[model samples]
Target chain A: MKCARCLEDTAAKVADAPDGSGAWEIYLCSRCNYSWRTTEEEEVINPEKRDPYFTLDGVDMDDLMVLVPVPPLKK
Target chain B: MGCMPACKFKPLNNKRKNQGVNNLYRDLREFLAKLEEEGQLVRYTDEILPEPDVRHICRASGDMPNGPAVLMNNIKGYKGKRLVVNVHGSWANHALSFGMDKDTSPKEQFHELCNRWDNYPGEVKFVDNAPCQEVVIKDDINLFDLLPLYRINPYDGGYYFGKGNVISQDPDEPDNLDKENVGIYRMQVQGKDIIGMQALAFHDISIQLAKVEAENKPLPVAIALGVDPVLSFIASTPIYYDQSEYKFAAALNGIPQELTKAVTSNINVPAGAEFVLEGEIIPRQRFPEGPFGEFPGSYSGIRKQVRIKVKAITHRKDPIFENLYIGRPWTEADFLLGLNTCVPLYRQLKETMPEVEAVNALYQHGLTAIIATGNRFGGYAKSVAMRVASTPHGISYCKNIILVDDDVDPFDLMQVMWALSTRVRADKDVIVIPHTPGMPLDPASEPPGMGNKLIIDATSPAPPDSVMREVRMVDRMPQALEVEKIIAELQKSAGK
Candidate 1:
């Protein structure tokens, strides 16, 4: 696997996906210590356990804040 | 059990067949043998210094899934003096060391432990002879030359006798074994027959010493090293002041604890211990000790601590020196101290709020706690947080208390963090106490032993606002076992 930031062949392990699936994996470039995640979808995402990020809306400040790095604008 | 029963608890999974009864480890050697049999012990033949090198390996090795316990056979300077580190390193190994079923869930283990704090006086058998007293050296005592004492951190003051239990009886009740207190305190080797022991002011030993010093008398003590592995856990735990650890240990193992009277003092030492240092803490003798790395993951500055004049040294033939690294996370201290704090706190919290699902003392550091409860009333989490922070056993050294909803698993750091990030608000959810009792070693605290405490109410909102969460669940929530199975299958296929 190639790291997105370093563009070098890297080692990787399956990481918890944003949607909680085994499909996604995180790769790390050993030389530069850069990492990125990729997904290999094998099954449909269950609505009850779908990607929390997918359901996020600007008005849903709490969930949106959780998915993003920064807090949402005041209501 | 003198204390009121907090909650009705029965051991979980009783319907599951009981594994055949196995003998509990009698001493350090037997515990090592058990670990070896289970393929959980690794020995290093290469000579390593008793200082940073051994601790470094222990710190690194503890991160493995079921990390093997380390036994260093050769020391850099000391000859024929073997050193054992990290017998309590791994979670699996730690559970096994205490004769607990490793397959059971952490919640089940907590339930099983809830009733262990009762005041039942179990058998403490005293034999006429003991292995610890096989070779008694009353004169010409040189601690450095005889034992391979460890200097764990680079900035430590001097060589320390780590992982030893100091046994002392209340001076006022000289003849009563029930009033005896055994605690794990670090001893810095000062000279041929003297060592500085750090028994902090909060400890029961300090209280007993204060009373003795007021009476103008020295407190008799026997420091036992390399004892039965279970006793180490018992000593590290916060058994009430009135309860003796010997009895608690005896009750926990369903076996009698064997003790031997020290030659130089009336105090009793574990009969199966590898070594015993008989000594007395003089009425007013004080010496500078520490600036050493403590369990809080920081250095505690130098302070005046009581010094012990070693009157006699007793040990078995070929004694193994057991040690532990105090600083940083993911060490044995985390597991021991975490359970010690969590079990009692869970019981006490349950007495008030039975909805408390679980509690976790994050590291051996014991500064932070993660609690899971079902309470959803407005300001309920605040009350839960306050109760946990003020409980005598819980608040002693802890600074951060996080309360999560019942759906969150407190033991899993990821789940707890997820709750904190998704459910909590800095303005509304965070409650801060301006000043409270704090651990002396925490560098952030302004004064040595006093600081602020933070309560993070990470629980999901109650009533009308609770529905806003969208009843979310991670798809991978139930895939833990599947993930483990797949990983094992892949490793087997890859011939790893």
Candidate 2:
């Protein structure tokens, strides 16, 4: 019902829900366009399944850091 | 100390919020729809449970899509709360939220951001208590009760705070000092009394946290639930020790970000903020924290973490909890916070290092910076490269830095590497200094912030007395006309 931040205005929608259930209202001001993605009341959010964080070892940071090799210079 | 001038912005309540998905809601919501329309947001209404296994779905999809946003409608716990995932993870999405073309380049966007932030309002106001205070959960607080705090990745020891901003005060400075700073630190929830907070060593926030520990004092901080979006950029904005986020947020918002006195401690919270966690880090409260995935594309196994005593919990009647995932590219952490702040940094670097031409937050803001400079002499590119990895604006977020010459686009690594391969001789052109320093999440280095980094100079070699080449062909007119037709055709095809 109430908004976060200003806590004055009413809430409308959720920005990002890890779980599919909880309501994360989009906090915004009708005037300044100061908007953010947050969930005020996260009763139960069904977060999407993810991989093991350790899987990062499966790939090299260098490889991921550099998506493509920079080509050599031209004449 | 002065009030920030006003801007044309207004909250998107009645005018922007609640509009039909088709009528086009605010910039952020519309972008969310675009992600759906583009099939980027996988509408997973699957009957999923809130087990750590839930992370499998996102990992199974490979890396998150860079162009379109991701939205999951069906969830297991807290059925009343709706969740939206990965909204500001890529440049495309962040651009759309701020009313820019999805394809807007980082160089252009960062320049605009610095300018827009300059107009940020600093005049602050306050209310006794706001949304975050609406529902008070004092004392006997158990964060697990805030369900859905599951592990986001395989390496992660448990659920972590990857995207949210951790607002803390600088302890080295006087409590009431003018230079109060607030930074976005990764708070990985380790246990009931402890959360692993990765405050980069080079940063002031971490230093302050250390100071409190030195004297065995609890560091009080407010983890904002739902405040304003610009606060993210503000959190990422470089600070001069103990600089109040309110001042920077005020300037960034083009109006003062109102503050409310904390009920549990002597901290100021944004009046508009949703949930405010009034907690203190008991000195030397250490625990095993991570093994969580980070931007450097890796996760460091469990390590000693910090402690945060939950003194009070406040939020709106139906507060929305914000969370994000790491361990891969295209997370909002990479997009909005990473690349979002790159170009402006390149521009800022130029004031001190003119040779610095361009910089970009590539692969989700992990350094990978592509620069273009006219390296006139020996070490010209090296000096510039070093600064890229060490400067508060540059090195603070970099895991790997690649410096190029004027000919490189900075946006295109292919161009930068081409310059490196040809112009730079391995030992001569490449500058790899170990312990280059970076974020704690960079698992490749020493623990978190204590690590080394490498910088490769990809600039072209200077001419020995300069030999002339064949006369270049100038086809500007034809090129412009050809590009014009392609743009027109694409616009018409997309029905724009």
Candidate 3:
């Protein structure tokens, strides 16, 4: 399955419903790390139905900036 | 207008039981019971989706001025789990968190909090056993199976623990109890046992993490979920680095805070928390984190943040997962961070300038602050505004400062507008300093953490300034107070 946000095929099943009723399954995209459940609404699970502002299509993974730069290891 | 005889009315404290200071709650369950008793909590038992339904209801609650805290009992996918949001959304609920009367005004609550600020560094009691440890999961722990996680905003990248209080001690001074920090930072669920935390550069956790990273070692952290109401408030407060939040929580509630040690680490956590995730922040490790809806009513761009590897998860049976909904203005984030932001700034300002009356830093966690102070000299108000920009929390968060007269209550926007409209001469009253350190979550920051600071001096000019000539002010008639008393009595009788 392709991720709804990044449109990558890195989506893989993370967990299923704890009740063992086959109710829902959670999927996480390894590329962009967007996680969603199958039972969620179309806007959150389906790529076509997601908001355009949040979609990461055609975005470069290396372009994201680091919020806090990692400091050097002490000698 | 004719003068009326002076009515002998006592002060606010002399009238009631000091606004119910003895009603200290120990846990979220106790606080929820009190909220339900006060008609400030609402329960929805219908089965609902975790995504849009819960977020939509919480956003709608933010639209209401006096919305009740919502408790959803029956979620479709999760069978026995429960979720509560907006517990600190409205002024009424915010007042109830302090054990104050539900009808207490925000200004009165602000003053009460300020009055309690004098009693700093209260005691914390360590207990042997806690309910949070009733059920422990150390092997093969999965967050999705435990927490009823859901996206708060439609554009959020993933589910977030928006209200968790992260407790950590300084790596350099691990034995110093006063240096222990309990703060609220946004953590997103990346995998079953992995969490991505946004420890901003200015936050206390970042300072501790930096020290640990210098030695290339993991920083121990304990994430406390569904803490007591007062603990949530104190966690979000930006107090001095050396001050302990547990002690502040005790002082604010006029009682001692209860704490317990985590299973894997010596870090003390609130014993009343519903769940505790004992983890270690892997030093020098960064991963993609955000696009979460921030307090500034904007979506933070995706950035590489630190990752936490959970070692264990402990919780009380049938735990209620608490989350905060933050989007546009006036959401639960505003109320949660409102007066806690004000009291520290007010206390710091009073230390140097005793003439400062009150501070209203309710907007966006004090990116903008409204201060009321007395004019000691020609440009005293400007000096007060500059001092506000230099305080510990003010350095990064306070970008806009509005100074008004002591007579004008900073909590009332109408009075502030009147002062701004009548007293401010734009050329002389408005001052702007360029390239100041600012909060990165603020969208207006050019380089994400650097921006300009603005000060609007709305106080009346004293001697030698002479911006205005022969200013005449109108005073309220003595009969007005008598009329107010009469109208209050009439409204009470009519049940208005």
Candidate 4:
């Protein structure tokens, strides 16, 4: 990773830490000792690889035609 | 309105000897005191009994913020021995510790973390050796001889190494030594001679570690028992793959992180570390471990995991063992993994799904994560949801992904659930996808190493879906200024 400061090539890695009781992962580089998370190699998946037909609610994708805003309660 | 100064870094030199090293806190009292002074920590000096520490604290403390990082230095049983427990186990403390804004939403915090990553410059101030080297157990060491490693929650198979940074430098990537190849993975203790490495293959660190194994070389490893709050934070988050974790920490600390090389391995460690254990990962080492409390809120019994051979144990002269609990609700499980990794990760995902509004990692500890976004018609939420679940980090453990409207706070389980209840028809809005890489710690692992994941499209559907005409009402928390007025009046009346 290029050092954000000197732009010199350096060894770095993120440190494991707790951001309170919430969740967080810290990034750190060993060479220049810099820390931060970058969007460079991040992968975000809605459903993991080899997803099945049903979701957490047991709903299928092909046949479902759901409504938006969801009608309010009858009561 | 904006983030603090961006993270910065500087090059290290072998020319410097005995320069400045972080003041390593060997004593539990000193560690707490330092944290308090820096405002990165608080202490409860409250007296609490042992037998029920896990049940009493983790069960009741899940939702409270600003909880003293929890150091029960004085315990009734197990001969006192000064057991250091409860450090960084609250949501507010998480923010305060990192100098983040408490008023900022979790989703916003995640965004700032991502922004911080963009300008972060990893830094390391090298010193010959510091406190972690103050007391070294080079030859052979007994596990039980040191601090009390608690069996948190009843079903725990045994006392685990719940506290410690299991670090490994990529042996195959000597050329990639710009701090980009270092990794601090968490390992669970299985025996005096074994600990579990629950790394998923998708983790770049794990993938690199595998490369070392394939090359048949012992993977050099070190575990720092205690470190300054920010340094510890660096090890846990998914900031950047090529960037150094410590530099990210420096960015957070707004200062250079001091480092000293490990006596055994070539890996550099935080100089302020209370204790550092140096070792190596042997290839194909198997052990029967677990039955420990997982984030799923269950005792996942005996699973196959890698067994680590204890090498040398090194620490300050009188090191106090830090015991962090797991299982049930509000444990460090969510603190370090769920809450911490989620924020920065939410930002990284936005790089792909730019319109995504916010994200939250549920209490299920990586197994369940939620994301909220503004719908742009034509499967926008679904596509973004897919990317979120597919993120290298998310693929490993996140299942049960929920996408909600921007009006909903992904971090707020209530709002997410509300979207699921009102906008979702169970059979319609809910979109299911499965069979992805999962947490090795997850009990649902299929035979021959296979697992499944599902995403529930809980977002409000595209416009003109016939349901857009539906009316909905949502409640908001009281404003901060109003609450402040009441508190100020109460304080003044009491004073007068």
- Best TM-score among the predictions, by candidate number: 3
Report, to 2 decimal places, the DockQ of model 3. Answer: 0.80
Query: Each candidate's chain A: what TM-score?
Result: 0.35, 0.25, 0.90, 0.26
Residues B393-473 of candidate 4 have per-residue lDDT tens digits of: 676667667788776767667867778887776666666565666665566765423567666777777764535566666
Residue-by-residue lDDT tens digits, candidate 1, A1-75: 643332344434423322233433344333322222342121111224433332211222122111001112223
After aligning candidate 3 to the native by TM-score, how far in Å is the CA of B275 from where it should be?
A: 0.3
lDDT of 2 by residue, B178-295 (tens): 4556667677654443455655456666676666666667788777755555566666666555456677655544545667777877677766665677788766544444556776
Per-prediction TM-score: 0.78, 0.72, 0.96, 0.71
- Write down the TM-score of model 1's second chain: 0.88
Give the winner by lDDT: 2 or 4: 4
lDDT digits (tens) for residues A3-67 of candidate 3: 88899788889988776767789999888889998878887678888888788898877778998
Candidate 4 Cα errors over 4 Å, as ranges: A1-75, B1-31, B34-66, B73-80, B100-115, B175-196, B425-427, B443-453, B463-467, B470-496
Model 2 has a clash total of 95
Off by over 4 Å in 1: A1-75, B1-12, B15-22, B50-55, B63-65, B101-111, B115-121, B463-496
Off by over 4 Å in 2: A1-75, B1-46, B52-74, B172-178, B191-194, B376-379, B393-400, B434-440, B446-453, B463-483, B486-496
- Judging by TM-score, tell me the better candidate of 1 and 3: 3
lDDT assessment of candidate 1: 0.69
Spell out the clash pairs found in candidate 1.
B334-B364
